[model samples]
Target chain A: MPSLPPIRPEDVAVAEKTRPHGAFDPPSDAHDPVRAGYLMRLGDDALILGQRLSEWCGHAPSVEVDLSLANVALDLIGQATLLLNEAGDADTLAFKRDVLDFRNCWLVEQPNGDFARTMVRQLLFSTWQHMLYQRLTASRDEALAGIAAKAVKEVAYHRELAAEWVIRLGDGTEESTKRTLDGLAWCWRFVPELFEVDAEVEAAVSAGIAVDPRDFEAEYRAEITRALGEAGLPVPDDQRPILGGRRGHHSEHLGHLLAIMQYLPRTYPDAKW
Target chain B: MSDWPLWEVFVRSKGGLAHRHFGSVHAPDAEIALRHARDTYTRRMEGVSLWVVRSSDIVASDPDDAGQLFEPAADKVYRHPTFYEIPDEVKHI
Candidate 1:
């Protein structure tokens, strides 16, 4: 293990000046910029999805599903709490960051259109997240490794929740099958974006601080086909890859989501929960 | 959809303790019943194990049968442990 450099008080001052909690612009050249960006990417995925799933709190098709989705949302928020805490102050990282500053993958930011849509989205993201975190457990960065190790188990359960629902819906009544198939269609375009690598991610992988998610692209494809196939749903391949979230580019859906989710913190900047 | 059938949940908090009925949930099938059981009953890390059975599967005598069912035991004082001279050294007893 290479020794991390000694932390100077000036380093803290510089980091804060470059990137305060509510600042609109990300730091241009902060220390460990790639690592900080990677942590934000990880944090934003959980935060966005956690916000999306929370919308189902009172409106699920069934009470069981309501609790199930809420529990899944709770788990993602728990992950967000830890991951964002690592990058910066957890509350500020979540509540203060502007929508354009979030580095979540495009898939997680898609709207939860309906129950089928939400579950299918979860199935896709959680499966990838499980694979991503499993690989990250071996990262040379101790904080990333420790967070990934704990989160891997949580995502395994999330994958199960999503997979089971996909099977249940896809194999259920004619209406359910149609809805689930349509749901998959809604999210299919965003699938390939998960594997898109940028300079920062590339550097992190080279430095052993992160794993290249593209490396597991083949396995992810196979796992998806297996899980969805058993549920009698085919992997839809007609859609094109839609990329951008890692670079702070997002869909129109995210702005609407942020309007509702960020309203409180933005409105009452000084108030406590 | 209407509520799934109700399942009574029982949990074993620790070794050597009997599985005590905690609460219940509604699920369409046994597998989902177990999932719901875990989510609802064990979210607090309250138990080592879970059991979910259809609430209707449990047979219950009428509450009206209270006298005939359990009253006899009340008068059977000899069957009670009060008469035992429990020794201080008998740890668990």
Candidate 2:
């Protein structure tokens, strides 16, 4: 039999700190198990989208754009780590979970169609994240408040970067502008998901663990409108509620995404990387 | 055609310090250049202030003139205080 290596002091300290705080003892009045689950869903949304964006690491239209996308992806991943680690632990939530256990929104799992589509997705998502994080910074839950305060600054930069790209692509040339409009048209329906205030959200907000998603709708719309206007693109009046991901009914894209994301982990079960 | 021009970036890390040359970025105009500098160079809050000047507009000393312009000062030991003594109470020199 092979003997295991001795554990280091740092590893022991980290392990002691991250030991699970008993399964069901909520952290605070605001810390609902259901809402923690919901926060995980939001975190997963950012994680999946960040992973998708990272695929363009070496294939972007320009080096500046490549670096920008990579930076944005890093910011999203940072946000995901905080939220996921809070929900459970970073390692367990990220690596130990099965595909069926993930609760990310469907739109985030969509394929990166083109630069235009990616920009549109980013614009929509960053707009919502900016508003959400801004309000969440004032959350009664200190941990959540801290996370939000940090993330708010990052999401603000993401919003500006995506907004600039949207304008540049939309107003650049006839082909680019047409593509930008088409991308916005395709992505507009999914915008409703950002503001879908489910029961869990309401409960969490009432307890001060989370912000009311509905409260950000007007600001999101205004920011998006300004961005689209500057981009020389018309905001599509898609009022339909194309919702389901929050309830676990996701678009077909999510399954394919999960297959790719979970392949290595599933293949090497319990293996340390 | 890239409408943007390259701009040299200078960052002041904190208060009461001179802006040190950090890097450069490409941007469409001065306003956008400052913004690009902020986004590209100061993402870590490493700077409290920034300055961006068009690279084309900067007047740089000629590399070929290095011998004539700087070599004369290299041997000027009289400009230094090697031959002089400082008082013990002198805090900084």
The lDDT leader among the candidates is 1
Please, what are the lDDT tens digits per residue for candidate 1 over residues A1-273?
998898799998998889957554433333677777888889889989999999999999877778888888998999997777777677887877787888999899888888998999999999999999999999998878999999899899999989988999999889999999999999999998888888999998888888898889999999999988988998897587889888888999898888898788889896863
After superposition, the stretches of candidate 1 with alpha carbons farther than 4 Å from their true spots are A1-30, B85-93
The DockQ of each candidate is 0.46, 0.23
**Candidate 2, A1-273: lDDT as tens digits:** 998888899998998789887544434433558657767876888888888898888997755567678888888888898787678665567766655677776667777889999998998888888888888888887877898898888888888878887898898899989888888887888888878878877877777788787886887888888999999888898857688777777777766766776677777887764
Scored by CA lDDT, what does every candidate get?
0.87, 0.80
- CAPRI class assigned to model 2: incorrect
Which window of 10 residues has the lowest lDDT sum in candidate 2 chain A? Answer: A23-32
- The per-residue C-alpha lDDT of model 1 at residue A65 equals 75
TM per prediction: 0.88, 0.82
- Candidate 1 lDDT at B34 equals 89
- Model 2 lDDT on a 0 to 1 scale: 0.80
Angstrom error of the Cα, residue A152, model 2: value is: 0.8
| Ten-residue stretch with the least lDDT total in model 2 chain B | B27-36
TM-score for the second chain in candidate 2? 0.81
